[model samples]
Target: MEHTQKLIHKIINLTPLSTAYEHTPKGKRQLECYVKNTCGITAKHLARIYRVRQARQLIKANPQLSLAQLALECGFSDQSHLNNEFNAILQIPPAKYKKLIQQ
Candidate 1:
């Protein structure tokens, strides 16, 4: 279990989740199983979560940044994309989150 958590952290921290995976010699099926067992989510989903976390960090660093700029910086397609992610993951939109953080 310790090794499993270490592997997950390596994938999550060392690189963006999009390119973090390397399928083993066994095959794609094994890779899929490994991903599911390691983190219970797909790589694409992990990448989205990572992007939102990155956005949040950037927001904290520069509270004056615009949502459009934050989205672009964090690799979201647009402001709405960032907004959707913030709402889905955080249950609050980026604008409101920013406002609360500033207080």
Candidate 2:
């Protein structure tokens, strides 16, 4: 339990949208350590959530990727899961966000 708390703390302190997916195993340790200490969340969970954030940035950068593809690439189970988390974390659905960006 205490270990989980520590992991959660580390995750909360993590930097945004790092480009470390291509890092070697050892290089990924910092991310593991951070996620371990902060959320006790599985590495897969962290990866999925982090990738979604990355996808959002990619959308912002290009605005060309379809939402379905974005959700899949981001490791979300589907567009609806992406929608739920996107809305929960950002207070807006992806569709709404895309519309807002184009406005």
Candidate 3:
């Protein structure tokens, strides 16, 4: 939809990637607004999606890292927490996903 694309472009133009997001309510509000206006998704879902992507990158960087370490680095509670989210977003177990990538 042109309207959605325009909204996304406006948001991207307004919010720089270097903007700090953790210390202020305004940043959180902006993220929530962008998610709603652009993707019709919730901030909670977006956060999980971001964490999963970050976890993937971390795994690639450190293939020897334990799942627990990856989870902690990505802000999840522990290995099980990361596993739960990874499964929810990726529909596969984290171990299997890691093995598949290694091979």
Candidate 4:
């Protein structure tokens, strides 16, 4: 249990959950099960939320960064993916969020 919590913390700090699972001592399936049971959210969902959270921080810190660049830095596949996920989580597009912050 202590080890699992450590693993989860490590994963949360790392970008791109796919690669994080690959590096885990246990198989991906076992890690997924442990995370789901312990956290009450699937690892994939947690990863997406963490990515969006990181992107939001970056957006605030550097409001001038382009969406594509933010997407790449946030481990998103593309701007559209970042937009979609960001919208889903925050109910606002990244571009609009940046503009609001800048104003």
Candidate 5:
């Protein structure tokens, strides 16, 4: 339990969208198993959520940033990818969210 918590903490603190289990001392399969058993979600899924959360924070902090720039900073492949994730998670596009925040 303590080990799982430590791993989860480490994962949460990692940069957005960094889902590589290779950085962990444990094997990829072990890390996956720990995450799944502890959090009931795959590490990849958690990473995606974390990325979206990070992007939201960044967007709120800098509403003037372009979607493409946000995508790059948030570890998304491109603007479309960021848009998809943002829409999926927030149920609104990034531009709309930014407008809402700015107002």
Candidate 6:
């Protein structure tokens, strides 16, 4: 249990959108298993969530921030990628969210 907590802490501290497992004979599988078993989510999902969370924070903090810049800043591949992921996670695209914030 203690080991699990420690591992979770390590995994949680990893940078956003970085789900690369360590290079070892079984490192990737073991890390994937640990992430799934402990977090109840896949590593890719976790990374995606992290990126969206960052984008949300940026949007809220800087209402003037552009979606294109936000996408690049938050590690999204492009504006469309950001839109897709943002909509998936928050159920609202960044542009709409910005508009709502403006009103």
Q: What lDDT score belongs to each candidate, Candidate 1 first?
A: 0.73, 0.62, 0.68, 0.85, 0.79, 0.75
CA lDDT for candidate 4: 0.85
What's the ranking of the predictions by TM-score, best on top?
Answer: 4, 5, 6, 1, 3, 2
Residue 79, model 6: Cα distance from true site in angstroms:
0.4
Tens digits of per-residue lDDT, candidate 4, 1-103, equal: 6545756776678546666765667877888888899989988888888889999999989999999999999888899999999999999999899989999
Candidates ranked by lDDT: 4, 5, 6, 1, 3, 2
lDDT of 1 by residue, 1-103 (tens): 4433434564556354434444223344555567677778874566678878888888889999999999988887899999999789878899998999999
If scored against the real structure, what TM-score would every candidate get?
Answer: 0.74, 0.54, 0.68, 0.87, 0.82, 0.79
Look at candidate 3 and give me any clashing residue pairs.
Answer: none
* Candidate 2 or 1, higher TM-score: 1
Q: Which residue window of length 10 is worst by lDDT in model 6? A: 16-25
What is residue 92's positional error in candidate 5, in angstroms?
A: 1.5
Q: Which stretches of candidate 3 lie over 4 Å from their true place?
A: 1-34
Model 5: how far is 91 from its true place, Å? Answer: 1.7
lDDT at 60, model 2: 86
Error in Å for residue 42 of model 6: 0.3
User: How much lDDT does candidate 3 score?
Assistant: 0.68
Q: Say which candidate scores most in lDDT.
A: 4
Q: List the pairs of residues colliding in candidate 1.
A: none
Q: Model 6: clashing residue pairs? A: none
Per-residue alpha-carbon lDDT of model 3 for 1-103, expressed as tens digits? 4433443443333322224343234555665676577676765565677778788877777777899889888878799999999999989878888898798
Instruction: State the lDDT at 29 in candidate 1.
Output: 52
- State the displacement of the C-alpha of residue 15, model 4, in Å, after optimal TM-score superposition: 3.4
The number of clashing residue pairs in each candidate reads: 0, 11, 0, 0, 0, 0
Local error of candidate 5 at 36, Å? Answer: 1.2
Q: Against the true structure, whose TM-score is highest? A: 4
Worst 10 residues of 3 by lDDT: 11-20
Which pairs clash in model 4?
none
